[model samples]
Target: MSAADFLPRSSLSSLIDLLQQQGYRVVGPQVIDGAILYRPLQQADQLPAGIEQIQQPGQYRLIRTQGPRLFSWANGPQALKPLTFAPRETLWRSHLQADGSLRFEEVIETTEPTAVLGVRGCDLAALSLQDQHFSGDPYYQQRRDSLLLIAVDCSHPADTCFCASTGDGPDARAGYDLALVELDDGYRIRAGSPKGQSLMDNLPLDAATPEQQQQTDEQHQKACQQQRHLPAFEPSRLIHQGQHPIWDSLAEACLSCGNCTSVCPSCFCFSESEVPELDGTTSGHQRQWDSCFSEGHSYIHGHRFRPDTKSRYRQWLTHKFGSWVEQYGRSGCTGCGRCISWCPVGIDPLEALTELGREDVE
Candidate 1:
């Protein structure tokens, strides 16, 4: 309901273990290949404890510091979407016997109540956008029912990030069970949901001091000031620019490699394949992440839809920034800038949108 503070880093590990004891799998940022990745963390020390990442076009690396603060790093190479919507899974399985008896089995649903520790604000917004697409729809309730989110403030942001302009963050606003703003010595923890309240009720914590509250406020203000500071565009106005020539021009440099969509925290498109046995009597279906940019993704009635790279690129950006709100009632881009940083051709979405804005003025 409100915020609290904890002084002990050792207790933080205990808290994680306590959550694990309560059957919640603790998911937090860990170091992998010089990048921060969301994975199961057994102790607070296992987290990229005091490491931050420096990111730029075609560059990403980690730098270490003294202290046990989390959220020290910037966003990672992979987005958060695949955590719930797994990139690869079996949809269902089929079996056929020699007697020609056919049977189909639906996969059993299994979910570990996940505690997402140190989720970045941009990722939180991406989850919000995904909620509209999945949880907002009645069909996706099953998946939404399983996650427990714990978001952390962005003490540091990369050069390419523009989430602040999008009203999503340098700090998380909603859709978290608990929100943490890290301090040099401790954490100012805010409970964002009843689930968090229940957990904190058992923990040894006290009401935040006025000074601690001020630190939280000041930390957020500083983070807001340090953003990439890209120009703002209203989400509602995105659609009106669909016919603008900026899409075609930007497509020229796009490799149509789908690198942007793949690394985006909100992109959820996928494809299905049938794994048939040698006897051809049985097969199981496998689901894998797919993108609109792939050539084989367009087969329809023996013909490809949106065959050209220009059209494919246009379709992706248009849906992500322009029409996604109408289609899913949310902004597709989370302002994560993974797309901008990870794109093979280094095409910047904000720059592209700004160019379109310039055309409107001209």
Candidate 2:
């Protein structure tokens, strides 16, 4: 840790002004429909200040607090996934020609240069994974390149958080241009990239005091004391336990709603389809986010490989905790625990893995 710069909370709006002046669309967390979501910001006051989240398996709630800190909550339902890899996009379009011939055009949506604030460490890890998965993909690369990341360390982790167990965060480690630690009056900030350094040089910042640095360390320690965790077991163990009885038991309570994959920051499964307009003059080749829980995900040639909930659930768990390591050199889960907090039936993967590990010992 090095000496850092401090920005007064009142002057936070100036940061937004500077970014806008630099032709960057600033996106940040805000309360919408009772949930925190990332949206375009015009000023710092638009942030979800004095808001805290209470999260548990199958539950999420927001409550207003007396504190003035802006980035107190652990996380939200969405991550950087939507900002980079779109939920639905057209790859190309085919237009009917007057001469009875067809012409195809690739669709590359114009992207504005963006600066995202209040990013979390687990989401940063997930973004890195997505970067690898979409490597060399022009659409993803264009969005990835046209962005700046400003991460905030978690001062209040929810009960569903297991990022520490996954070796990801409560603090921003890497992959962010700038990092922030929110204190009572303002933020302690540091630069992690050249772009961040440039912004730091321009902001109305003062040298961080020792008291602010101590408070930042204490906040980080508090966040690290989270209750949830991934059990100690080789992730490969799940790959070999394909026929384990736990799958059947889990399927009994599972909804197969795909909420887990939808909220998972690192899940990259998708399905492509041809969407034709009613006039039939044009058709679009569309790619949409998909989940392994969907029966159609494994459907091919009229055969649904994972025909039941059991197989589908097994596929998801195995791929997330097992084969993903072989493919990406790490578990697919960053352990943000959105899947646990968002599941309708309160099906917790951490508990499921613990049960499996207990069975292995028995």
TM-score on alpha carbons, each prediction: 0.90, 0.97
Q: lDDT tens digits, residues 107-171, model 2?
A: 99989999999999999999999999999999899999998999998888998998988889988
RMSD of each: 2.6, 1.2
The regions of model 1 sitting more than 4 angstroms off are 1-4, 98-101, 135-143, 230-249
Clashing pairs in 1: none
RMSD of 1: 2.6
With a 3 Å backbone cut-off (N, CA, C), the pairs that clash in candidate 2 are none
- Off-target runs (Cα >4 Å) in candidate 2 are 1-4
Quote model 2's TM-score: 0.97
Best by TM-score: 2
